[model samples]
Target: MGQPPLEAEIEIAATPDEVWAAISNVAAMKKRSPELVVMRTFGKPKVGRRSVNINRRKGFAWPTTARITRWKPPTNDGGNGSFAFYVWPTDVEWSYDLEPSSTGTRVVERRTALPDPSLSVRLTAKWALGGADNHDTELLAGMNATLAALKVEVEQP
Candidate 1:
């Protein structure tokens, strides 16, 4: 069995479009996400676009490739939107959902539950990533931090 899905949510004092601008810009995400060290995308980001990313924890770093699977911008009337990407090596999907909230926008960052991870991924998680469970716990914390940073960025004057 694979790890369970993980999520974190934060309300930002900005419109859904503003939030979407921040989340959709993969380059800026490297600054907000604690684990993301580098993000290089090929061509404009949209459904089917691909990116290469470098993530780090402690002193260990790893490379991951992902393809954009979902890219729905917020409606002009401040409706809901979401962005998602399917990652290789781990066979997981990461997404950000934006919904209009009373204050502004509710942003939810999530990692899909991995029901079946490859043998290589499992071994790498055990040997290099301090086991799947521990890394997942850290990933949850990172998600929280990432959202907090995004909130600050979007709300800044």
Candidate 2:
């Protein structure tokens, strides 16, 4: 079977628009994401927009580029929305989804399953990232941490 998608979710005591505000802001996301050190977007964020990202793991750092594939901000105060990007090198898509909930909003972060990573990506994962499985485990944990941090930030007064 193929690898399962990496996912993590959290409920925040804030509206969907409020959550979208945080999720859509690439600058703010850099602060929330554990692996993301820098994310520079060209102009405003929209579908088809491009970004340069620098990710770090301990002493290892790598540069990657991505294109925004989806950008649907909440249409109304309590509407659902999603944002996604297609990342190069790994050929994976990462996304964030927001849904209105009873208490406030439910935020979900997801990374597409990587069943056939490129040879270069495979080697880099093995050498620099402590193997694919281990790195995926860390990525799941990072997703959880990122969602938890976002919850804290969005729920703040």
Candidate 3:
């Protein structure tokens, strides 16, 4: 089987539009994301657009060129938000739902299983598992950290 998906949520003291603006910008993401050292794209990223995210400490790159599933603005209750981060071999889908309230906006990010990757999962089966180092656990932790940082950045001036 492919790698299991991870889910996380973070509340931001900002409107959905504000959060979207900050999160959508590749350059801006480099600053908001705790684990994402830097991200850049030759051009804009759309449905078939591609981008790269590099980890500073790991000194490794996790390249993903995913198609945008839902790019519509947030609904009254926050409904239309999802993206699939993919590597030719496999991909992870992240769907976000933001709900507005008196406090602020509640952003929920869900990492779901990739239906069928471009490549066979068997090729990297061994590396996919979370061994002693626990890559899977680490991924979730990183996601949480990134979301937390994002919340702070969006809420602050």
Please list the C-alpha lDDT of all candidates, in the order they appear: 0.91, 0.90, 0.60
lDDT of 2 by residue, 18-74 (tens): 889888989888888899999899999999999999999999999999999999988
lDDT (Cα, tens digit) per residue for candidate 3, span 35-69:
56665655775556666655443543454444455
- State which candidate, 2 or 3, has the greater TM-score: 2
Winner on lDDT between 2 and 3 is 2
The candidate that achieves the highest lDDT relative to the unseen native structure: 1
Error of 2 at 85 (Å): 0.3
Runs in model 1 lying further than 4 Å from the true structure? 76-78
Where in model 3 is the C-alpha error above 4 Å? 53-62, 75-87, 114-133
Error (Å) of candidate 3 at residue 2 is 2.9
Residue 50 in candidate 1, Cα distance off native in Å: 0.7
Error of 1 at 129 (Å): 1.5
